[model samples]
Target: MFTYDTTRATAEAFAVAAPIDAPVSRGRRRIRELCADCVRIVLADLLLVLYRLRTVGLENIPTEGGALVIHNHVSVVDWLFVFVACPRVPRFVMHYRDYDRPGFRWLFDAFGVIPIAPKKEDPELLARADRAIDEALAAGDLVVICPEGTMTPDGELSPFREGATRIARRCNVPVVPVVLVGLWGSIFSRKNGSPLSSLPRAGRAQVSIVAGPPVAPGRVSTAYLVEMVTLLRGRHR
Candidate 1:
């Protein structure tokens, strides 16, 4: 059987990087959850076969309760790694442009994804999307958002927006900061100005998903999150 180790050293480093002490809620899920246990296992195995996949601090993901997950965006496939590693199937807050793309709606719909567009594009649409996110959080669902808004054109982390902070504050939920390592030169990343411009790595490329303990809603901020993700990523591009 193929397996991976989540060493205590890694967990400790992540904890010290972002000190956190928040209550975990274990409540019955009120909304439909996607990615059943079996599906997650299968996807994880597939990822393992495709890359040198390593994860740390998954336990930081609350077993039950509404929480906001913030992560640095590197590639188009960043969500796949987060989905398989999280303890629960999280409702992804994705860009409407990507979520509404043809051939992807089926998958996004299955997970009850909340799609948001620029307020200038359609104020009503944005309002509805916000309402949907609120309802999902109230139902004790985990929601993941990339505050950078889009995948990075360069390997460096982009300036984070206030969306995550707003959600965590309004919903009164913990904010879990996550970082992805070693996805910079991937085919899906904008490594050379545009995605697919660069060739993919041969064999299994080393990748890591480091998830830190949840930050209290009161402590969540754009600058704080940027610092936490930067500390966790630590020299990895």
Candidate 2:
């Protein structure tokens, strides 16, 4: 394992401040390191310091109640914006590899990461993920899923994965479609299976986050979901 963090990489690492999902009254005691709210506030500040970005349609995120947010994956730190834009408290089930990493342990617990295996459809991993989704839904929390399996090296949306569909159907929740553009164009964009290097300076990267109304669970075919998201994502491209 490397002894330090890679510079100009798109990987994510941060702590949360407040609990957008659950709040504790003044008369009650709080759990250890439960600082999601603080994390959000800090993250907002950190993002501004790290890169220049433009977010649109964030208001579409429901101001209240549970929501399942689906977005195209680009930069690894893109999740920071998801938390910032979301109105309600948020939690996301992430790629299992992220949670399994040693240094990423803080990110998993600090930001409430849910383990999800994509490259390998391990039954055990699926079972754990299913349980986590159920608990999140039961807690009336917003669910953030990439549904694209993994981050795209070429800075484009990947084919939508089916696991998110299965979870949304099982939980009977509405799916919010979102389009993320420009996070990867920054120094954060990772190497495409080659020596790590930053793209030529583009005078700060441009990014857009568009949150559309939620799509309720249905019997729609996978092709339909793919087309719907692709078209919506194209709106800003």
C-alpha local distance difference test of each model: 0.77, 0.64
Q: For model 1, state the Cα shift of residue 168 in Å.
A: 0.5
TM-scores of the models, in the order given: 0.83, 0.77
Candidate 2 positional error at 231, Å: 2.2
Q: What's model 1's TM-score?
A: 0.83
| Tens digits of lDDT, candidate 2, 171-225 | 8777778877766655555544422355545454556677776677784345666
lDDT of candidate 2 at residue 162, scale 0 to 100: 85
Q: Which clashing pairs does model 1 show?
A: none
| The best candidate in terms of lDDT | 1
* Over 4 Å off, model 1: 1-38, 235-237
Residue-level lDDT of model 1, residues 1-237, one tens digit each, is 323332211222211110011122232121123123434566778988889987788889897999989898999889989988887778888888898799867656555678788788978768877888887788788899999998998888898988899999999999999999988888989886688877778889988888988999999888999998988888444
